[model samples]
Target: MIGRWHGLVIDCPDPQALAGFYEKLLGMIRVQDEPGWVVIGDAPDRPGVALARVEAWQPPKWPDESSNMHFDVRVDDRETAGEKVLELGARRLEGGGETFDVYADPAGHPFCLVAW
Candidate 1:
């Protein structure tokens, strides 16, 4: 590879809040915190998730053909993970089955909790 992967950056109206949600969901610590940017990861040197503040940001609508991407998180127990995410401001979406469940984060970004 020509370069190393840094992290996945998500755009939202509030970087702090969105980063906090992912930090708890992924059991990561905050690596960098700033006015418009926040990052969380296992450690400072490792690849992590970054949240960038975007003004006039519009959330993607679920089931819309124009929506491009989402995150799939692997977990040990779907039921437990589902409950936890719901408690953390995530709302369940329409599509899902025995092995996975879809949810929209507080900012309306879709992600999945898949059982391993």
Candidate 2:
């Protein structure tokens, strides 16, 4: 293999809040939390994500323009998962096909709940 995947890094206004949202959303544990940085993972050795705070962050309006990155979470039940995410402060985004539903996190990052 070329190299191991480390983790996804997300930029947001409040790293803690954004990380907390993902923690609840994905059941990922918070491994480390600093003032402007938050790390989350499923296990001690495995890779996860680091949420870093960025000043004057602007949320991308997906569909209007191409998103630099996006998350795709697989779920057994799409409708139920969508509802749960919506309850967790995700705004519904347009252009979700039959296989998946799109939403924007509290930080305005786009993510999808995939039934496939």
Candidate 3:
């Protein structure tokens, strides 16, 4: 069977902040907002990144640590995207080698930026 992933759920302390980070990063907007949840996407009527805030938020350990999953992001300019992401509250997690660099999102979820 072939399955298409719908969206990614990011757990964070502040849904608004995280959602804003992704909204700017992906050129998306807030589609839904609730007490403890906020979703951002290109189209409000379609599926996209879901930022779900929960009590007692804990960040995943990366590099030397393990995480359940991670996503790879394609960008036109890795340097520019890295800078923007950092400005948006994400931190550089890994140095660039040839094609990509790793970053930790606002809530410390690791993802990579690949040049497209």
Candidate 4:
């Protein structure tokens, strides 16, 4: 491969808060914390998630075709994971089945908790 995968970076109003949510959700450790950026992962050298602060950020609307992408997270128990995500400030979204459920993060990025 030309280059290895680094991480998925999300833009939000608060990098720290978003990073904290994902850190707990993904069980990843903080790798870098800066003024407008925060990175979390299994290790410093491994691929993970990054959050970047954006000025006047507008969240993507659910059920809209304008959305570009979303994340799918696999879990052992969908009920437990769904409850945990809601407790962590995620809002449930439409369009999911027995194997998966959709949610929007604090920053309004769409993601799914899947069990399959």
TM-score of each: 0.93, 0.94, 0.86, 0.94
Over the stretch 56-77, how does candidate 3's per-residue lDDT look in tens digits?
Answer: 8877766677777877889988
Backbone clashes in model 4, listed as residue pairs: none
Local accuracy of candidate 2 as per-residue lDDT tens digits, 1-116: 99999888999999988888899889999988899999999985789999999999999877897778999999999999988988888889988998998899999999999987
Higher-TM-score candidate among 1 and 3? 1
Assess the local accuracy of residue 67 in candidate 1 as a C-alpha lDDT between 0 and 100.
51
Better of 1 and 3 by lDDT: 1
lDDT of 1 at 24: 84
Worst 10 residues of 3 by lDDT: 58-67
Cα lDDT of model 1 by residue, 12-113, tens digit: 999999988998898999999999999999999999999999998898777774457788999999999999999999999989988899999999899999
Q: Where does candidate 4 stray beyond 4 Å?
A: none
Model 3 residue 96 lDDT?
59
The CA lDDT of each predicted structure is: 0.91, 0.91, 0.83, 0.91
